[model samples]
Target: MKLYSQTFKDHKIVFIFFLFFLICQGFFSTKIQYERASWSNVPKAPARTAYVLSFLGDEALAHRVLSNLLQNFGGSGGRFVAISDYDMDTVSEWLFLGNSLDPKSEYLPFLAAYFFGASQDKEKLRPIIAYLEEVGVSGGKEKWRWLVQAVILARFELEDTDLALRLANKLASLWRPGMPAMMMQMPAFVQLGMGEKEASYQIMTELLREEGDKMHPNEVNFMVDYICTRLLTPTQKESDPLCIDVP
Candidate 1:
């Protein structure tokens, strides 16, 4: 009983000191930890400002905005998806500004256009392609090539063949020495888009004749078979004397 009383007395003294220390510290110190999101005071400026800033040697900022836009479109995920119309417009405006500021920046505009073509609606692709053409006019060979790649993606992946063909023809007309011969395929695509399968077949036939020796045997055979298949549909073969046989 005496030992227990002494232990109680010791604990009471320690508790009183602990309480006193806490009170003393609490009076002088204030600790507040809560969930607060990071905030930036910098406004998301308008495209005009962004354009002006980029034109005035702030190209890095433009790149940053482009990067942020790409992230929003799920570009970081390796497969971009369509965004809302308003967000698309915002991203497009920023892209126009960025490309307009640095016409020679092939990668940014090329990537933006490719992602846009993959993810954007057909209604908006026309203006985007027009903008790319305008930029390609002054963006030199490398830029033009990249823009052409973006158009091809739109053609095959986005099913926007008409727009892609239009851009392709424009790029072909502006052909540089290093430009690939694939640009010439635009005419075939144009014919296909217009429901003129015969014209497309003729174009493919000419391509095979002109480039057959240069292409791998397998590739050549593939092209010939593809053309023949399209030209020699079962229903049309009976009446279609124009069907050219491959082999």
Candidate 2:
């Protein structure tokens, strides 16, 4: 009976120790997980040649892998990381590296404008916007749409009308013969938003003279209405040829 009692006591102690160990392990694991969930760090991108070499000299494969990694960088471990927690300058560097690897890919630009650009920290958007502009300009007509997005991020997201107008002007400079009228008229729109109605009027007038046939009828009518009803005085509207019947 004594021997049986001792064995039972020993087994009970062993079971208690095992339970205690599991509790401690769970506590520490939860602590570690909480800490990880609370903070995130953005790592700098590797050099271009080193990155390509790491992927067995396949630049295309490198770009694809890097893009995927970037998309999920701060959101791993089943934890949510706030966009504001990221160091956007470092993020911009990674984006630039990705672009260098594949300028033809729209992946990075899309991520830059829509994903990272959505952050509430508007100032951080500067570098990302600049990256978009660089890619948009260098990538030519096919990529010019990114410039439009950048202009939007600057105008509405960043609330920097001047920057928006500057990007709009840059977009205008890239305009070709068959391009959309909205692309060429982006500056005037930005100008109107900035309350530069006269400047906007002058731009629309030039567009009417230069590209009227190419512009859609709705676009032309909207411009004419804006000029006659909103911009010109009653006396000016009476004499202006475009405003003659625009009442």
Candidate 3:
């Protein structure tokens, strides 16, 4: 009982002292979270701004506002690029800005496009591919950028037979070592988009053979449904002769 009493007293004294410290800090520190940016009180920078603002940004206009901040904090050559490198995880957006500001930046737009699905707008992808073809890829890491762009374009269902075949060949060569299992499923989609039914089936069956695991009931059910959904869309009969790909 005596030991317990001493422990309680010690904890109580610590808690009281900590509360007093917090009260002192509160009186001296600026309440930055409630303060907004203005002429007299412009924020130093978004990342350097208080924690609350950074946390608030992801949902509340973060992507766009960050773009604006990067633009305002000096151009791509200076602190803006530094801020982007230090603060942002998705380097693509700032890369887009960088590449646009300096045409020589080969990787930024491609990286951004990959992260933000920048090529989803088919019209935008045309210019991106044109830029790539003109300036060309940079580093060893950059080869993957074009390969990824090609694959992304294929997924958009924009590329026809020749492009699909070319991309498949490139992916085969470049991606053989680190072949992400999920991507093997893509050839089926690409082949089907090209109206090659038998080829699509063969590729998809290969994917199933390699990746399918039914040890868990949930996994089995999910694979079954995912495969079935792709294979049996209402517009195409299961026995349709024109297709062989994942729907």
Q: Which one wins on TM-score?
A: 2
Residue 133, candidate 1: C-alpha displacement in angstroms = 2.7
For residue 54, model 1's alpha carbon misses the true position, in angstroms, by 9.5
How far does residue 182 in candidate 1 sit from its true spot (Å)?
Answer: 1.7
- Alpha-carbon TM-score of each model against the true structure: 0.48, 0.65, 0.30
lDDT tens digits by residue: candidate 1, 1-247: 3555667665687899899999988865654233233322212436666455654757666666665654454333344334424245555566666665556555455445545654445555655555566666664644554455446445644556766677777767776564556556664655465544564465456555655665556655655565556455766554544344543
Q: Write down the RMSD of all candidates, one decimal each.
A: 12.3, 10.6, 14.9
Candidate 3 local lDDT, 2-38, one digit each (tens): 5566676657878999999999888756565455333
Ordered by lDDT, highest first, the candidates read 2, 1, 3
* Candidates arranged by TM-score, highest first: 2, 1, 3
Q: Which candidate, 1 or 3, would have the higher TM-score against the true structure? A: 1
Candidate 1, residue 6: CA error in Å?
34
Clashing pairs in 1: none
The reply for model 1, stretches above 4 Å from the true place, is 1-57, 73-86, 157-161, 192-247
| Overall local distance difference test of candidate 2 | 0.79
